[model samples]
Target: MERLQKVIAQAGVASRRKAEELITQGRVSVNGEVVTELGTKVTPRKDKVEVDGVPIDREEPVYFMLYKPTGVISSVKDDKGRKVVTDFIDSEQRLFPVGRLDYDTSGLLLLTNDGEFANQLMHPKYKVGKMYIAKVKGIPTRESLRQLERGIMLEDGKTAPARVKFVSGNKSQGTSIIEITIHEGKNRQVRRMFEAIGHPVLKLKREMYGFLNLKGLNSGEARELRPHEVKQLREIVEKNKCN
Candidate 1:
């Protein structure tokens, strides 16, 4: 048995906080009766939960790593009807993406039905790193690279420090591939980071998330994260919380 919000979030309908708002807004029901209290506990196997009259799915905990393809938005569904991350998924576990990749960006994206697991990974305090290889408009200068590595100012604020590697460029600065790793989860951060330095990203592909990377998978393909990989993820979360 678990709290109502946890069940709703694990069902992939919304995050735990949003689920609480649904409860407070008097939108959730249990066993055909309205349940607005946050303390409501449910035996998922026996209880029925409805959000706006639609039954929430109770599925086994599942995790997946997908090599997101270009032009696919990383989301459960797009109101505009554009192709989304789930369009690459072949499972029926009611999973949702842990984070997002822009419609034009590509590479490593995770989807899962485990809400707490998603929370641990997305939380900035966990310091989960995201690594990307970006093809930018031009190679950045030494000072610009230094600024990026230290932390650059964006309108949202100064970005967290980043780890970057690449050549300053020869004659192919316009086609330079810059490798960057950061622990921040700001919106379109990598693209914005490069743009701030006058070398706007022409293409961006995430290659790693924390210790997980897209090695065997290709664009648009996905695979279940091995048990050991999941264990590592849990460890990362636990270890960080302890500190």
Candidate 2:
């Protein structure tokens, strides 16, 4: 037997924290009996569990890739009254983002309730690479690009060297699109890197995280990841040691 919240999470009902909320609210029951206590235990296979009077199913895990749009915060909640990423999802299971994308930035974001999966993707020591397309105010000089390739001293310290390339630019218009791949997960790292070189990023979007891409997914839309896709992601994470 396991704790009720763990059972709920393992059954894909919600994240462990949200499951505990449901229990406290008297929304979860076992065998038709309300169980509002936090540490109540039950056998998932032997006892019938329900949330809001609906039976919970123990199915395969769910993973989702969402094309995040600008203006949506990446967190689960914002005490400052800003809209959050969860507002875009309508799943019965409580899910959280694997990492974060700043409110003004947009692109591929992963959502899952599996804590282990989330941990694997977020741990920086794993060096999981993420690719981004950045639009900057000025066309970066080759020297500036070289500086980025080597490493830049930020307020935090010198950043790790990243793979940087010039995709295209309109020098006449003083704007350029550059592709960058970095293994570290720093707060506003990409933007800061360009800003340090006097090329303030006007827009930024992550195109890929590790081996996962945002192909065919439109902004604000999401879908469950295929089993093969999940396997590929796991393999990539393991191979790259992203966590």
Pick the lDDT winner: 1
Model 2: residues with Cα > 4 Å off, grouped in runs: 1-60
User: How much is 110 displaced in model 1, in angstroms?
Assistant: 0.6
lDDT per residue for candidate 1 within 23-101, as digits (tens), equals 9999999999999899999998889999999998877788999999998888888899998888888887887898788
Per-candidate TM equals: 0.89, 0.74
Model 1 local distance difference test score: 0.87
Model 1: per-residue Cα lDDT at residue 232 = 94
Cα lDDT, all candidates? 0.87, 0.86
Q: After superposition, how far is residue 44 of candidate 2 from its true place, in Å?
A: 10
Q: Model 2, 1-243: lDDT tens per residue?
A: 999988887765566767899999999999999999998999888999999999987765668888899999998889999888888888876678877898999998888867556666676666778899999998888999999999999998888889999999997889999999987778999999999999999999999987788888899888788899889877877877633
Tell me, by TM-score, which candidate is best.
1
**Cα-based lDDT at residue 175, candidate 2:** 97
Cα lDDT for residue 226, model 2?
88
